[model samples]
Target: MSAKQTGTKNRSPMQYSDWPIEQLPGLSQEEQSQLQNCGIKTTVGLVKQGKTLQDKVALAKKLQVNLQYVNKWVALADLARIPSVGTQYCGLLLHSGVASVAQLAQTPTHRLHKQILRLQVATMQRRDLCPAIEQVQQWSQQARIVLSDEC
Candidate 1:
């Protein structure tokens, strides 16, 4: 596909400050304050930063919290910031070898669906798959970023 055609069909790149805070559930007052202190006042900030463990650790240290706490917050923040990627689906994606939003975006639809279904069955979980697939499509269209397979 041509660049112009692709750009016209996808979601525009969103700014961190533009998103609302209410979408991110379970954020403690202290965590919120810490995020704000680090210029991460919105869900988008957390999503963009949380793509890497280094970034999460840095943010956690800044907040004086453990890495696991930051990771959970990052997952919640990513779900809140990105449309169609809910917490449950995010977990499934992780279980299916998708470690980042970029990886989810890069995944082909059929393979992603199969993996998601497999994960659902193995984990004994139920969730609507359409939204997650849609999210992957939307994210792929919007971002050219790809995830490295290596840890």
Candidate 2:
């Protein structure tokens, strides 16, 4: 089904831009710099093959850091790469207890839409914040593809 068929409108969703890797959530300043030194500059730059986290394991080994930490950053960056999720929306998802793309993949689209709606209301920036169910479907589908161990 299409968004138009489902009565989903654009609602002026927030626009996202590429941010420095240091801006990725859940990472300390040291870790951000570490990734930067290792050549990861932007969230989009971290992953190459679609939604996969690219070479997180290899990067961890090269950086001599905990694999979990690298994996965490990779996941966050992956979510940021979603068409509309961006860094700001990723922050909202993290604060709302949705941490990983894998978790986002599991979340019901209606629930995500509801939570995001509540967030927009609570924040009082309701301008064009409403999202259609179809957008959430795209997000979940993309996450699922990324999490299908296809990386």
The CA lDDT of each predicted structure is 0.56, 0.65
lDDT of 2 by residue, 1-151 (tens): 1111111113234222356676677778887787778777777666541234456667878778877777666666667755456665676676556777778999998998888778778787693666677887877876675555344
Given candidate 1, what's the lDDT at residue 149? 18
- The candidate 2 region of ten consecutive residues with least summed lDDT is 1-10
Worst 10 residues of 1 by lDDT: 1-10
lDDT of 2 at 63: 79
Candidate 1, residues 1-151, lDDT tens digits: the string is: 1111111112334421224443345677776777787887666667777768888888778889889878876765553333444433444455577655555567787787777777766666665543466655655443332122111
**What TM-score would each prediction reach against the true structure?**
0.55, 0.54
The TM-score measured for candidate 2 stands at 0.54
Segments of candidate 2 deviating more than 4 angstroms: 1-17, 49-54, 94-107, 113-151
Candidate 1 stretches with Cα past 4 Å from truth are 1-18, 25-30, 37-39, 48-54, 75-81, 84-92, 124-139, 142-151
